[model samples]
Target: MDTKLIIIETTTDDKEMANKLSHLLIKEKLAGCVQVNQINSYYEYDDKINNTVEYLIRIKTLSNYYEDVKEFLSKEHNFELPEFISYECKEVSKDYLDWIVKNLNK
Candidate 1:
């Protein structure tokens, strides 16, 4: 059977935090894999423009776990308002998709 999947995205200013989140998700079976990328971000907050280096975390997991993942991220995240966005996977490699489903514990 083809499994439904989603990619959840978030960002952190510290690599340690990124690693922590990544490991937590995998250890809890919330995500099959997490990819971290160093990125430069510029945005406005509190009436000022800000630029900073950040780590983008991409979490891949079954679509059914989206809400659980979102809740876990919000509670464990350090940011006052963490970015928790999800993109549904319309297409994925059959084998890779199977791997993701197999990894989920719930």
Candidate 2:
């Protein structure tokens, strides 16, 4: 039995955002893992160089607990509208997904 996983990509590239997100997710037992990556993308917002650093957070958890997870993020996130997107994992090996389930409760 595994949880439906998702990614929460934030606009900020700051390590602080990554760390806080990971800590909060795990602390609440809503996710097993939140892998963060530094990504660079170019954008045009307000005619400004919106080239920014962003974090790609891969979250793992039980499929049934998604609502609680969403609630927590909605209340805790600092941004007015944080990037919280959940994608269905089309394919996953049992071993890897099981590992994610195990590490989340640690």
Candidate 3:
């Protein structure tokens, strides 16, 4: 079977937490690369609509590391209920895919 490439996504309201998580993932070799972007999110809770600014963290890694990544995020994330979503890359460039595989811990 081909190597499964996935992009795990999560959000955080704290900038420091986002940076910390990104660094931890890369340093631990759980993620090949991590991208963080500031975003505005609108959601409803307790029958009230709320809008907040957050940091969107996109983690690039292999499927084999998903569980580790999830665990790390769950433990380090500041939000009560963090968003842990993964999207498999159906089509990736050979060069990019190889780079990701090479960067991840064996």
Per-model lDDT: 0.92, 0.70, 0.92
Residue 3 lDDT, candidate 2, scale 0-100: 59
lDDT of 1 by residue, 1-106 (tens): 3368899999999999999999999999999999999999999989999999999999999888888899999899989899988888888999998888888854
Please provide, for model 2 over 1-106, each residue's C-alpha lDDT reduced to its tens digit, 9 standing for 90 to 100: 4455554444445678778977988887778777777888687868887777677666767666677777877787666777777766767778877776776666
Candidate that beats the other on TM-score, 1 or 3, i.e. the better one: 3
Off by over 4 Å in 1: none
TM agreement with the true structure for every prediction? 0.94, 0.74, 0.95
Put down candidate 3 lDDT per residue, 1-106, tens digits, no spaces.
2468999999999999999999999999999899999999999999999999999999999998889999998888998889999999998898998888888845
Worst ten in a row by lDDT for model 2: 3-12
Query: Which run of 10 residues does model 1 get worst, by summed lDDT?
Result: 97-106
Distance from true location, Cα of 51 in model 3, Å: 0.5
- Residue 45 of model 3 has an lDDT of 91
TM-score of 3: 0.95
lDDT of 3 at 64: 84
Question: Residue 34 deviation, candidate 2, in Å?
Answer: 1.0
Say what the RMSD of model 3 is: 1.4
